[model samples]
Target: MSWKDEIEQLRKRQALAKGMGGPEKLKRQREAGRLNVRERLDLLLDSGSFREVGSITGRAEYDDAGNLIDFTPANCLFGRGKIEGRTIAVVADDFTVRGGAADAAIIEKQIQAEKMAGELRLPLIRLIEGTGGGGSVKSILDMGATYIPFNPGWDQVVANLERVPVVSLLLGPVAGLGAARAVSSHYSVMVKGSSQMFIAGPPVVAGIGEQVTKEELGGADLQLAAGAVDDAYASEADAMAAAKWFLSYLPNSIHDLPERRETTESPGRRDPALGDIVPRDKRYAYDMHQILRSVTDEGSLFEMGRNFGQSVITAFARLDGWPVAVLASNPKVYGGGWTAEAAQKITRFVDLAETFRLPVVHLVDVPGFVIGTRAERAGTLRHGARALSAIYQASVPWCTIVIRKAFGVAGAAMMDHTRFRYRYAWPSGDWGSLPLEGGVEAAFKAALAGADDPDAMKDDLNRQMKSFSSPFKTAERFWAEEIINPAETREKLTEFANLAAPLREPRTKAPRYRP
Candidate 1:
């Protein structure tokens, strides 16, 4: 009465599952410069840490006498895994199996993965490839029926956004549901040359008179430029490494605050370069990235959305080893003006910080919302309003450093003035409703027009305005809490991190707006 026979059969089924659509399909997958699902999981997680769910839940056939004959394992591979010894939930599409189409997928595995990630409060990593469980004509023929479409476990997916960190990697051609899943993540990446994302593949698009290749339609660079995904990498391994690095900065879920790490860098260490990074001339754009890296712990800044939303830089960095959200204006792009894309990026980034209980440090150098017919058509002001709302709604500890120009509505958004203003200004801070350069003529139109030499009068008015616009004037009025030397930025920011660490409380946040 031993269960040895059944145990052997179970092992046999598990072995079949491991085969993963057999060697031929796997060979093709490798030839396409992609790793199989199992290989991806191995690379993504700590060695030998994957504990697979539904190992044998797939199409099976048996003899009339009830003896097993053949089995085809499900396309969806999901389980609990470890990244840097920390547990995470992973759901990867086995593209070798029917190209990971709906017919070959075991939907229960995906649903359970999402559910477990939320219920157990673990970060969810989706290695998306193929169509992301989207149906095909073959499925209808196999089932002998057509049905109205609906996502099976979408509630869990949406809930996980607030409950846990969701990272998706687009590793291959992804269409329909796959594309949606990648964009839904808190962070997403694509392998540069291999990955493509679209509403539908080229074959389907050709029917609509748009004959385009997959790469032409939705290449990594294209999607990154469109703000569809956070970043891209030259290789799948690099992308996976990036995902691990991103998770290292945050906790398993919103129910836990980000843990601090040990760093050799001194909190009071001052980089002299910070003092000269911002040129006195407003027309010149200094390297914001250099400033960001100098202010944070060595090699700790993990930037996202680099290609799209060029005017704003969003990243996760550590100050004295404390995880913090870093937002800065990229003066190199439109003089740090807020474009529609930049505003949208800010809104999403602020929501992420609020959801995860990450303290925010803003490096302000904004001019204003971009103006012109192109900006107007893009609804720049509307998106900027949403970004402002996100910033105001965030309850996290916030610190703002006015490095240079901070004018107009965009500048005012550097921090919520109504809150306890934990803010500072540099010697070069030039803030107001409008800058004096182009604004003098518009503001003092009659005064300049009545002058004997309008241009000279305008220059004289600018000089007077510049004197009033000095950061000293703002500091004297207590409009800005303090004006500190640029070299002291690291000390002040490290102090802010220490202050914010105690205030970070672990709890679920309101639903994040994903735009």
Candidate 2:
């Protein structure tokens, strides 16, 4: 009767906890096209790199002999893990355990996991499914006491956003606290068709006389459009891959800068087609995404919030192995204007970059902030001003490239400096207070009124302004830093990225991340 009996008892408990919601539940998870808790961790972390923290914690039933009779593991899978050799804290909830009910100890454990990430200053990854410590109707029946549902550790979670990188992946239905955790991260991913996030599920909302399916309430398409989720993947494996790829450019914490990676992609690599990508005519549009990919490392352009704020594209990419946060205007939507939603997206994206110390790259083709009645009602100007303030306040290195039309305040928002700037303009660059096409009439109104043919006078004025609007004129006055061939834009940009690398590594800001 030595310590061997105690060791065997502990092993028995651990084995049962590892079984998760049990064999029957694992089968149901696979049938529903979702990866179980353990499988998700395997897919996300490097092989044999996960060190689980609380594998033996949960409700249990033991006999007087201290032998395990029945055991129920916590609904969470958490601990320290490595993704690509970088250590991070992970919190993945097991939905199979009574649908991730709010068992008291499990809630405390989840809170501790979040605090550990913040205290350790490590990037936190939340693979959330089901309610996060949500109400358990069955638990109430067992305890014979009903209690209100709530989640602690929100403050620690928010602090994690400012201290380190945070990403959340929603692989199943998320309600209550789970929904909050899903959207609170700097980056979030949802599995298409299989995932949904809502304030309350249909069953709870049905009490209010409303009935809607989970997908209809908070599907991937809907959440992405709402700008709460960043990207959507076809399956859990795809989402897992996405999460790993995203963390590649980010560091473990804001106390340091993102690590530079070895690259076969040459710094001088130029896309010959870049010269022809931006049309000479402002009325015509080209794919901004294609241009982004061409300038970035091959196959390294990871886009965020694609469905929401389509006019402005925010992406994380590598330029010759240097990680960069790219903000590009998409003329394909609203002629590249900054809508209210787009402004919000840009401000948040810029904050993420500043938090993680990623240098900013602006591919400017902005037409200005969104106009018309809807734009004003949505307070586009307020959001635009906030975005502008973020750009002005950020101390991160900035590089601007005027690819096409850049007009008004939105165009000016591209960068805040003019002297000794690492900025470039392509041959297709065209800029003014407003587009010359529309401004010519206002600028020479008296002269046009006096002309016999107002239409002809307008055409003459257009030709005259076009000549003055050349990027060459701006360069002649030294207002524009460099006007390079479009083919050489990427090469020049790579040089700028290299220059910015050292400046970012030493970070001493008290508020490293501004929400």
Candidate 3:
């Protein structure tokens, strides 16, 4: 063939692949108020920065003259692109074609995309929807045979988790392997009304004699509350923006480190309100969110697992524009005691921070792990120990500011216990093996039972114990770190962040995750 003829053939093939599924299917995507796969890329990436990887791949129908008659592209689309001046990889599912099912070269392309991201040490943004290259009924009919359920690229998928920063956006109904991919990323988002995720869709559930609608099975509200996904946005555009913002806080890969940026607030900035942030009366509950906002840079707290672990708040925040993981105990829930679910949440959050080499800050108020029949049934101790193990295994710098009560084993798990002299307690802090109120009842039970004025005796002992257990007494022994003014938290934490910045080893080791 002449050069001119070959060029004409190339143009024809490019036109076929670029056409996507066709106008009719694409119109349906628009009618549903969602952007198509190609359109999503345009919105997500810097304009004209996306470089195609497998644009010529698809199922091509050839005529007798060896001329192409039809073409159906792979449901998976991928390539390198720039987001906010940072280079990264993007993989999106083309639901218009085969519902992103097992067809053509989608399975291979999807697997390759994961491998490429890891190899290039780039961040990966997954625009997930449909089946995520899962089994399709039509595929079996076309092949005249059935195959056992399996995920071909799962190994690469799993490897990518530790190698790169991954963000998944659920733009449509995700099922089976699709759901797994959507949830596997470090950060994930879903469109509030349009996105749903499930291990199996309604039709698959019907085969097992169960009846349920798609929304009822795995709606964003249920999934977010259950801690299956990190967040949900009102639109795909918003979700994309969130994904971009998340990447801004993280490095392109585990091999690199997150750079600090300038913020509107100075490092030494302090709010006078934090002086009275905690009430002297231990019985009253204060809003932990207020403390989080006051200490961290303005609008930099990205909270995770807020619903599943109400007792503990795990969030990503910035101190002097340096990213740090913040864990604060909320007294309103179980008296800030750690539950099994809350412990698991801590393990996961710690892993993210450590993997990205971020420092950690603990706003301590824990009384202990949740205690009761319910807690025992939930294996609270087992999960609590795992959460502790995760903290101990982390190599990043850690600091703790004791805001209130910190009692028993759960208190010990608050920070890197090995980082001696690193703990900081507040003036209102009260920590011991057990709170004075509870200790008096247990220790003076015999004395109280025999005393004529049992109630008075109990009250007197509690008062004495509370006075003896003051933070000053512990500081006198040089056991706990200095007890500072509550309002000084931001200034101290910002200084600590500055001190820890140079201590982190290059490409710091990833976190030890609790199962």
Task: Encode model 1's per-residue lDDT on 264-360: one tens digit a residue.
Answer: 9999989887888888778999999999989899999999999999999999999999999999999999999999999999999999999889999
Give the CA lDDT, 0 to 100, for residue 326 in model 1.
Answer: 96
TM-score versus the correct structure, for each prediction: 0.98, 0.94, 0.96
How many steric clashes does model 1 contain? 0
Better of 2 and 3 by lDDT: 2
Best by lDDT: 1
Candidate 2 residue pairs in backbone clash: none
CA-lDDT, candidates in order: 0.92, 0.86, 0.86
Better model by TM-score, 1 or 3? 1
- TM-score, cand. 2 vs. native: 0.94
| Shift in Å, residue 264, candidate 1 | 1.6
Residue-level lDDT of model 3, residues 1-515, one tens digit each, is 46998888888888888878889989988888889999999999999999988987889899999988898988888999999788999998888887777654457888888988999999999998888754677778888997777888888778777778888999999998888888888888989889899998999899999899989999999998888898888999889988887888888888888889898798788788888878888778899999999999999988866777789998888999998889889898998999998998888888888888888999999999999999999999999998898888887889899998889999988787666547788888888888776788898889889999998998888778867887899999987769888778899999999999887665644443221
RMSD values for the candidates in order, in angstroms, are: 1.1, 2.1, 1.8
Which residue pairs clash within candidate 1? none
Tens-place lDDT per residue, model 2, 120-204, is 9888899998887546677678788876644588878778888878889999999888888888888899999999999988888
